[model samples]
Target: MATFQIEGGHQLKGEITPQGAKNEALQILCAVLLTDEEVHISNVPDIRDVNKLIEILGNLGVKIQKLGKGNYSFKSDELNLEYLESQQFKDEGSSLRGSIMIVGPLLGRFGKGYIPRPGGDKIGRRRLDTHFGGFIKLGADFRYNKEERFYGVEAPKGLKGADMLLEEASVTGTANIIMAAVLAKGKTTIYNAACEPYIQQLCKMMVAMGANINGIGSNLLHIEGVDKLSGCDHSVLPDMIEIGSWIGLAAMTKSELTIKNVSWNDLGIIPETFRKLGITVEKRKDDIYIPAHTNGYEVASFIDGSIMNISDAPWPGFTPDLLSIMLVVATQARGSVLIHQKMFESRLFFVDKLIDMGAKIILCDPHRATVIGHDFQSQLKATTMTSPDIRAGISLLIAALSAKGTSTIHNIEQIDRGYENIDTRLRAIGAKITRFD
Candidate 1:
């Protein structure tokens, strides 16, 4: 158990580089299992979830070499198939949600895959039907053992591609089916596929490794089955969610901060969403420069004179992941806005913690919250709290950074699972935070 003690009301300055995308790293690292050659990866974020997946790979006899900082080469030339069924593998695999993604590559290359029920933040009902359903549609036998809480997929004869439509634009589901269909015997057409930058990067990496995939950035994809795949080098894009968080943090704390190498073009609707909250975001040579808020930012009104509402949707829409940080930022804005988190039912529960710190928020329902900004007129009082999830944990930290006194946040492991060296990075930018176990 670890905790963070932070003193608020200090303005942070200097340039902070966002780490490589955590979500992208999850998919990219798991894709390493699809090939037997040495797949070199760079700009990998050193986080708990990623490192745990790497450990699971090493446990399965995947030859891994740590080349340097944020660099690694993975060779899955030999594998321990029995390790997937071990109690140890089950325990480790169940500890992280990313572990479930490994099943696709394993099933595609080795004709069998097994996984325990995945574990992650308790935000909402993230079903695995999308994943298993795709595998089943692609000529694999799927079974679930309720007593053991495990899922198994096998293609004794070999996987054969088929035309199927995903029920929803599930990101992991799309990636899983893509990985499986790459080695199948026929053509595969996937409709309503998730076209997020993370998925796009994975497809590009697959192309580099000799997978035949068409429609790289759209909902429809056509894949031709290949005999085998080779390894290639892949460098992940910068973390866009973190960039948005830093933008909100700077505006709330009235700080001057520059987020370096943000991959501006790939941040679909993120910067504009913050600008809707009245933050000045300047794109300077692939970096985002957020100026100090001396005059204070205001929440914009709709054309119909109604209070602005910020909601989450699929790709090309506001990502549900950053709604927590946006809600935190709205607490200090000059006007009121409604924060509607449409994707996850339980994610907005963290608003109660912000309300404890003197922010005016109305929890309309599990999916929506209304925030009335204090506009720096009232300072948030320090309080003790526990983090429920990754985004909420960072949101609370941002709130504490702009509060009146010292605040303590427990269960910081949730934050570390996503963000790499968060406290160390904040300290470099003049934030007063200390970690203790």
Candidate 2:
């Protein structure tokens, strides 16, 4: 276990280039299995989750060669289609939610895929019903063992494409089915598919590898099955979650920081959402330069001319993962605003720490909270805290960094799972922080 110690009340300054998308990187890595030739990937984030996926891929008979900084090439040559049983695969695969994607590719290519129920952040009910729904759609049969808490699927008859509509736009479910459909017998029409930047990246990479996919940016996707796919070069997009994290960190600490090479096209309504909080943003082409200062918190009214709370739904809306960070930023704003987390019930429970810091907030229920911004001018005192979830853990770090005295953040492994050398990056930007094991 590691801990981060921070001396609060210092402005974080300087410029940081964003890392590759974590969500996208995992899908891209799994897609490498679809091809036997070498697939070159650049700008991959060297985070725990991505590294764990690589280890799992290696055990799957994928040869991985790290070419240089943020660059790697994978070759799934002589992929052992036989049943895989490795302790490393299970250990690393169990740590992240993204590992569920291996099921589709393995079943499609190798005829059988086995994995345990995954363990990530304990935010809420992250069910695999949608994923299983996708597997069943692709002609795979599922079996589970309650004693081992493991799941396995077999698609020996081979996958035949079918028209499928996801009840919800699950990112992993879309990725899973898309990977499975690449080798299916017929055309697959996936309506209500998740078209987030990550899913789009996977689709683009699949196309480069000769997968015929129509409707790249729309929720309706058409995939024409191909005999085989060959590897191609692809780069992961800059992580939107990291961009949002930087935005919240800058606003909370009142620091002048520039996030470079941010994919501005994918940032639909993201800038507007932050602007509603009174954070001034200077957009120069693709780069977003955030100047120091918060202009008081403002509650966003709906376009329907009604009082509406900013919350998380699916993609094209505010992400559920970032609502925790946004709630922490609201602690220093000027007015009151409601934070609704429609996807998860337990996501907003982290406000109790900010509540202890003299901020005015009321937890309405499991899925909603009313944050009464105190315009926290007086400093927040330091405390010993343990991180609970990935987004909430980083939010706690921001709150601790902006507080009055020194704060010790324990259980930082959760934060490190997503952030790339986060303490080192923050230190480069004038944050007084250090990590200890």
Work out the TM-score per prediction.
0.99, 0.96
Task: Report, for every candidate in turn, its global Cα lDDT versus the true structure.
Answer: 0.94, 0.85
Lowest-scoring 10 consecutive residues by lDDT in candidate 2?
80-89
Q: What's model 1's overall lDDT? A: 0.94
- What tens-digit string does per-residue lDDT give for candidate 1 at 322-376? 9999999999999999999987899999988999999999999999999999999
**CA deviation > 4 Å runs, candidate 1:** none
> How well does candidate 2 score on lDDT at residue 80?
62
Residue-level lDDT tens digits of model 2 in 1-437: 89999999998888987899888999999999887899999999989888988887887788999999889999998776443556656666778788899887776676678888898888889888888888888888999888767888888888888999999899998999899888888999999998888999999999999999999888999999888998899999998888998998899898989999998998777888888888877798888999988444455567886644788877788888788888888888877778899998888887888777666778989998988776766556677788998899999999998988999989999998888999989999999999999
| Top candidate when judged by TM-score against the true structure | 1
Measured with C-alpha atoms, the lDDT of residue 414 in candidate 1 is 97
lDDT over C-alpha atoms for residue 56 of model 1: 96
lDDT winner: 1
| Model 2 local distance difference test score | 0.85
Each candidate's clash count:
0, 1
